[model samples]
Target chain A: MTPHDLKQQAQQQLAQQASLDWLSLPQKAQATFAALDMPTRKTEAWKYTPLTALLNTPYFAHTAAGQVDESAAADRLGQLGDVSRLVFVNGHLHPGLSSYSDLENQGIVTLFSNANDAQRELINAELGTAFEPQQHVFATLNYSCIEDGVLIQAPTDFKVQQPIQLVYLSSGEAQPALAQSRVLVYGAAGSSLELIEQYDSLGETNVFHNQMTEISLQPNARLTHLRLQVEHESLSQVNGLHVKLAAGSHYEQHALAFGSALKRNDININFNGSNAYCRLNGVFLSKHKQHIDNHLNLEHGVPHCNSDTVYKGFITDSSRAVFNGRIHIHKHAQKTEAHLNNKNLLLSKQAELDTKPELEIYADDVKCSHGASIGKLDDKSLFYFQSRGIDRATAEAMLCLGFVNEMVEQFPNTAVIELARQRLAEFFNDVDQLNHLWTLE
Target chain B: MSKTPLLEVKDLVAEVDGKTILNGISLTVNPGEVHAIMGPNGSGKSTLANVLAGRDDYEVVSGSVRFKGQDLFELEPEERAREGVFLAFQYPVEIPGVSNMQFLKASVDAVRKHRGQEELDAPSFMKLAREHCKELKLKPEFLKRGVNEGFSGGEKKRNEILQMALLEPSLALLDETDSGLDIDALQVAAEGVNALRNPERSFIVVTHYQRLLNYIVPDYVHVLAGGKIVKSGGRELALELEEKGYSWIQ
Candidate 1:
């Protein structure tokens, strides 16, 4: 059978499971996936990003938890410091590697498949309702055949002190494999939570990790989310994050991503109620024939919601990066304030960056501005460093780090910043000129 | 017995973007002596400072500058910095990502490494930096911020002096350092510069106004106009230029 047929069959089987009510959403998503298939070059959203690796890869379903490196996952979590860390290896949760028993017991965090009856009812309501499926083919595909996923719910007036850490690790078998996992968060009224999710794999692992995360913030709820995609150049990744904010809610997201063979991220934020605020900051890097694409959409359906977003990209050595940010204000989204900015550094002559920032506003009283810039490092800044007795290579490295470090410094979580710096140093060290960057510390 | 001048420039001719700024500018600065170079606008005062620091944009059409008995033009800008040459920029570039302490530490390490000196430990470096901050009347917290990120004009000049104290260059070039400062800041900056003065160090102060000379007294003064040194005299020349202005010597 074809991949599409197999996906439909899985969804049909899930739909028939009488014990699992959440499977109904997957059944619907499967039909949506059939209608809106994987994007191709002709698709406007996927024009500059060719999914050659993903389209050509003969991906087979993942085997049960392959080669779980207990020590490695444990060591990584230890380095991440004190947090409710949940680790999944090869699409299977590793209870020994995870340390969120307290959260799991409270029903604040639990596996979607293993949730209790009441918890399952809550998850069923919030599982697939954050973003529109028509624009996100990968997310629909992921939901249709999700193997196992996480569900985090913060009840009314509940405030979590520590940021929750989700560690998604891939350990591929000999054959090319696809591992799909997900996370759904429901922040109830007056609730707040912080999340730090990391996606990583070991050297040369041939794994395509398809993951999705959905978050819903009720009125007066606040959520601070951070995502890091680093240290896996050989893998293919398609990830999506969708957030829905209610009245008087707040959402802030920070992402630091590195390019791989084929990496695409679809981020969507929808303001369903008024007086909600959103802040998003993202930095992406690509080099050595890698490709990274970020398609972001901010929807303002209500009034008095403000959003500020900035995403920066650094492409070098024949790498390609694509950024599309769209802010859509409905007819009644008056008094809405929005700003979007994207600045990119195209290092090598052959490197390419395609950026488009669009503001579609129907509200007459709204204030909105958007701008995108793509260029090489500033010569004046380089000269400034050189004048201070720094060599050109070191100066370039500093400047490159500085470009991305600006956004990274704004992250509210210090642990995430430290982790990002470590990963960024490692990612930049791949290029010859940016070596010895760690010595600058 | 005679000692070689710390810096010797012979018929220095320079240009930027096809525009000749300094034409046949020749001067000498001996050790422990401060030479004030008074000039009007468009007289190559800043260009001379830039060329001495080996700025790449300023092309040396013809001339030679010898620092510490070596060809100054042959070294890279960083190398020139390592070889005890410091140019306190008129407008210090704001580097947003690099913190002040980090930039200063990197710079100090580069110079120290080039001089074959051992690197300072973190604690030692912080202690020394805080001491310099106190000396400049700058809050130690400024060291934690980006280089010149939000510093006021006077604060930036004092930061330059702080860097000067840390790098401890032998040949210092002050380019329009006092233009943006009020009297109090100028005194603080001058006092910072004066503290670094020693028998092994020499300074070439380039300024549009002679008020800075009142704080950091100069041994000799030269008037640069139409791109060349039109007149030279003792400390009295700065006073003369301050009284009569560059049009008298032009």
Candidate 2:
């Protein structure tokens, strides 16, 4: 079927389902999706990340097909250690494989399918308010097909001790399928929460994942968000995260991704009130024939707000990557401090990277700077290592690790840091020349 | 008793970036003896030192160098380092994010493994490193920081000496180790080198000024002019050259 027919089919299927109280938003979202065109190479924001491969693929909306093995689910939860977990298999919540029975007693943790009347009212009011449907087509598509997702609410003066893990596992073993997932998080005044969103696949099946996460932080609230994406080569993913901050609220994010055949993450953060802060740190690795892209936009609309960002990437073999970071400071937002830097290392002749760091400031008293650099290893540093009895290959591996480890050392969780280190070692081991140099033991 | 020299250089010619820097230079060093090479600015003293360390930037158009009955040019830079050749650089490279302790451990272990000696464990290596740092007047905390990163001029020179003491090479090439040091720092650095002297170790000290020669006395002094050894004599030759300028030698 053509791409247009596919969208019509998805919309018609959603309209035919039993009309519920939550179906109103999806109906409106369907209209929005119909009015907008799919992103292509001609689109200004998506010039570097062509959507031809994504649009041309013939994929049907996901339906519950195969069963998830209990043992396999348990094995996939390796070493995350004593934390609340919420598992979703093929866009549906699996309560049998999930933990966190007491989180609802403390503040609020309820799935959309099991939410109470009051929780449902809150979800309906705040669900699709963080982002505009007419701007992002994938987000609109995600909302048009949304079925069930998680809604987390930390009430006033409440604090969560353990991190909450949202695990999205794809088990589309029967046929090529598409999955759409949604997450809405609310932090009330003087409350805090730590959330980790993990995406994985079970078997070697062609699947496309479209995900959207909307977060609203009330005054004096704080949130720490960590997103880890590690999937099989047969999977393609498009993720969007939209966050809004109030006065005296702080939001920090760290994203680590191992690129699939195709992956893109779009993050938008806005400072809506004064005396707010945000920091974004990311590290991405792409190998073989994979492609990865990261686009971040930070908007400072009020005075006395600060934002800092840094991203590093390692591309090898025939892989490609793109990074575009833009900071916009409005005319009245004085006393704003913003900085961004992107650095990349290309390990092969065929590897490529396109980076653009932009700053648009209309305020007179603002401090904003952006820089981007792409280059290979330094020859003098390599020779310095060789003079100390280290081989060239080993020296290269050590330098690359040191470059990426500068950001990895800042991870707040020890278990995640260990996992990231192991994954990096494996990536280096797969390269032909650096195989023997990176050893975890 | 007469014995083979520890290092022998016969008519070495070297160039860098298509320009000849060393024109037929020759020198000999015996075990337990220290030789001082003094020259004016841009007189090819550093070129000779780098060429000995197998820096690929310096091309040896025609040369022959023998170290303990083996051709030195046959090995790579790393191989030469494993075979007991140490060059104390004038300007040490700063490598951020790599702690000095880790770099030193790797270097010492590689040399020990090559010489059929057991690798030092962490605790024992720390003990040895502390002793060397004490002799060099460097703080023990220097080992925890990045290698030569944000280090002062005197500190970098002392760190280089500490490495020379730890590796314990048969032949140590000191290239302008006292150029930017104050009097007290120069004394400490010279004493660090003096403490490592033994019957089985030799040193080739390359310097421009006669001030450093006062602290570390040499058995022989040679004047390198126009990339050739024009004058060679006992230690008093350094004093004579110090009284008159390098122009007197030519």
Per TM-score, the best of the predicted structures is: 1
Model 2 residue A412 lDDT score: 79
| Total backbone collisions for each predicted model | 0, 0
Per-residue error for B53 in candidate 2, Å, reads 2.1
- Local error of candidate 2 at residue A242 (angstroms): 1.7
- Which residue runs does candidate 1 get wrong by more than 4 Å? A1-19, A60-66, A116-118, B244-250
All candidates' TM-scores? 0.94, 0.88
Task: Judge candidate 2 at residue A38 and give its lDDT.
Answer: 74
Q: How close is chain A of candidate 1 to the true chain A, as a TM-score?
A: 0.94
Q: What does the lDDT read for residue B39 in candidate 1?
A: 87
Best candidate, lDDT-wise?
Answer: 1
| Residue pairs in clash, model 2 | none
Query: Interface RMSD of the predictions, in order shown?
Result: 1.3, 2.4
The positional error of residue A316 in candidate 1, measured at the CA in angstroms, is: 1.6
Q: On a 0 to 1 TM-score scale, where does candidate 1 land against the true structure?
A: 0.94
lDDT of each: 0.85, 0.82
